[model samples]
Target chain A: MKKIIYLDNAATTEIHPDVLNEMLPFFKKMYGNPSSIYSLAKSSKRGINLARERVAKALNASTKEIYFTSGGTESDNWAIKGIAFANEKKGKHIITSCIEHHAVLHTCEYLTKYGFEITYLPVSEKGIIDVKELERAIRKDTTLVSIMFANNEIGTIQPIKEIGEIAKKNNIYFHTDAVQAIGNVSIDVEKLNIDLLSLSAHKINGPKGIGALYIREGVNISSMIHGGMQEFGRRAGTENVAGIIGLGKAIELSTNDITRKTGYLKELRDYTIDEIVKRIPDTIVNGDRVKRLANNINICFKYIEGESILLMLDHEGICASSGSACTSGSLEPSHVLLAIGLPHEIAHGSLRLTLSKNNSKEEIDYVIERLTAIVKNLRELSPLNK
Target chain B: MEEYSKEVIEHFLNPRNVGEIKDADGVGEVGNPVCGDIMRMYIKVKKDIITDVKFLTFGCGAAVATSSMVTEMIKGKSLEKAEEITNINVAEALGGLPPIKMHCSNLAQQCVKAAILDYRKKHEK
Candidate 1:
């Protein structure tokens, strides 16, 4: 059996052992509904409360402000449509960026049909939204501004604090999808003046199907899901006990080792980028170098498609992702790449290799070796190379 | 990752006949830039039989491997028989693709049919 080198951490990280350990009790021994009023349920409620507090402290918010959801998409939908529908009488205007995850973009699109006007701010070639442009786009009727803290594809970290301040000045509700940023970077909701925030556990080496939204106290956002009194009636579903437990443990572990692990990933990421660019010609790194995620490296080879590159890498036992996994089967280039000003040809050739603590320098070197050979071979056959 | 069949991994690791044929009898290209895959196929037909076939593909490993295998399968076969090659046949040639990567084999089959159509169009004219 060939040993596989897994590098596609951006899609989802392997669940940490500690997180799994923390969740095991909930799945078997401590199986009690938090909503139930019994001694067993008390412990479950306590676990949920403790997890909420840990998450809140991580974001510098109150535990009462946090409401759990399935994942980033659910949190995003609740924040956008929930706010838009609740405040429709006040204003029907919303603002977001072109590079936002489809969760936010598609929700906004749905709102547009209901008479809400959306202003999608454009990013520069490096995939950073202009704060000045955002300020100029804001009108008196603009009720909400939802921007992602970090882009999933390009890994560009936005100026969320500055954007939050602008939203504050304009007295608009600010929501940031921090699914990719939560464990990777420091986030102080109060410091950033963020009104609402979204996060997912899968991005931080936790189990999937568990996430949370931090809505500031007194925010007028309505619930998208209706059911029995759950999540303070804000998000209605039986609490995901095992998933939430794993998420809490994952966040705790991530926050504890964030500084050291981030430094390690940054070193490995830079080394990989340096090696790739040194060996390959006409390759451009996507996203801003300085203001990007520590784990993400998105690059576009001038004349080769990313799918081909990934396929060849797979054969070499190295795993990675193209710009958009959703469009991998289709022949179309990534919309995020197109939005960041890549030409259609270059966009099709984008590869995103995200790192994690599990990745090592030796693995990165092996990847570079295989990638170089594959690119050279594929480019030789590409008519566009000439 | 699941254990891939030996043939699938073989084609992926050592894809055969990958590249374009210059001045070919017929050419066919599929997949758009936005779609994240592009395959260009060239055919050299002699007396209504495909004497040689080659493919240049910019896609995932399965796509490149499928194209390579498709060309190898069609070479020396009559145009009518080559045109009958289906996605199932191409996938089976590799012992089977992942469910997600099956589309790549489908793309390869489409390219073959298209190339045959192009040959028929030119020869009839």
Candidate 2:
């Protein structure tokens, strides 16, 4: 088998060895239910509590405020729909950005059909939502304001602190789908004035199928999923013991090594972007260069389809993704790219190469070399190319 | 990643005949802006036989590969026979496309038929 270099970290990450190690015992010897009262259950409860503490500490929140769920999508649904239904009496108005993940966007769309008015805040050409526009869009009955901490497609980091401040001033519950931002950047719920925060374990190298939502103390949220008395009855399902342990361990590792990793990834990401622009003419980077994720590089090759570039890159043993993996099978441009004012042709040409800690400078260089060759070849066949 | 069949990967990695022929005898473009994929096909037809065929696509790997394969499959065939190309045939030619990518091949076949109609329209005049 040929050696493949994986660079689509924004979509997901390889689980850290430390996290896997932490989760091992729970799968076998410590497989007791945390809800049970026996000695075996006591150890399971202890593990759950410790993991909760680590996760809460990472976000600067109380452990009691964190409710574990399936993953980002579930957490997002719980935060958006839960709040929408719970606070329907207050005001049926909700405001979210146009570039939110499908989880948030679709949830908001669902709410719209249920008599909940929704205003999609537009982002600037840089992909950051206009704060003043958000302020103006707030209504007396605005029950919730949900936006992503960072965009999954373009990697643009929004001004969550500012948005949170506005939501607080208006007495609206502020929620952010922080799936892409949790480990890549510092997130303090109190500092950012975040009311409800959604996180996914997989994005931070924990496990798949496990995530958590940080609900500020005193926030009103109805249960989206109901079953047995698990997660303090906030979410009702038997706890995923191993996944929670892995998530806790992963969060701990991410928070501890974030500074060093951020620096390294930023250096590597910027280097790759710079080389791509210099080596390939008419290439443009999507999203704000400075405020974007440290490891995400989205570029448009002016006259070529991103899928073609990805295919060539795959043949060369490089793994990455287009702007929207869900829409990759279709020929339409990415909604995020189109929202940012890219022409349809250029938008179709978008390619995203998101990195991980495991990716080295040598790997980055190899990708750059392969990508340059691929772009040049694709452009050679492009009718729009001069 | 699912192990893409050797033929599919070959078409995807090195798509054949992927450029537009300037001043071609017929040209056809299809796809809506909402669908996110668009294909423009060009053909040089002589006495109802396609002497050369090429395409320009703005879409994913499946779309590009499908268009490339379409051009290759129809280049030496008569216009009437080229119209027989179907989405399934294009997909099967590449071993098999993911179910979701089937539309890409559909778009390619549509482009071929539309281009043939364009050729017929020109010749009848």
DockQ of every candidate: 0.43, 0.44
True contacts kept of each: 0.56, 0.44
Candidate 2: count of backbone clashes, pairs at least 3 residues apart or interchain: 4
Candidate 1: count of backbone clashes, pairs at least 3 residues apart or interchain: 12
Query: RMSD to the native, candidate 2?
Result: 2.4
Tell me the spans in candidate 2 whose CA falls farther than 4 Å from its real position.
Answer: A324-331, B1-5, B18-48, B114-125
How far off is residue A224 in model 2, in Å? Answer: 1.6
When just chain B is superposed on the true chain B, each candidate scores a TM-score of: 0.92, 0.92
Per-residue lDDT of model 1, residues A286-357, tens digit only? 999989899999999987777667767876788898864324444456778989888878887888999988
lDDT (10s digit) by residue, model 2, range A1-386: 99989999998899889899889999989989999999999888888899899999999999999999999999999999999999999999999988888899889999888999999988899999999999999888999999899999889999999998998888999999999998889999999999999999998888999999999999999998889988888899889989998889989888887889899999998999999999989988889999999989998887777767777887788888885332443445677888898877677777898998889999988888888888888777655664
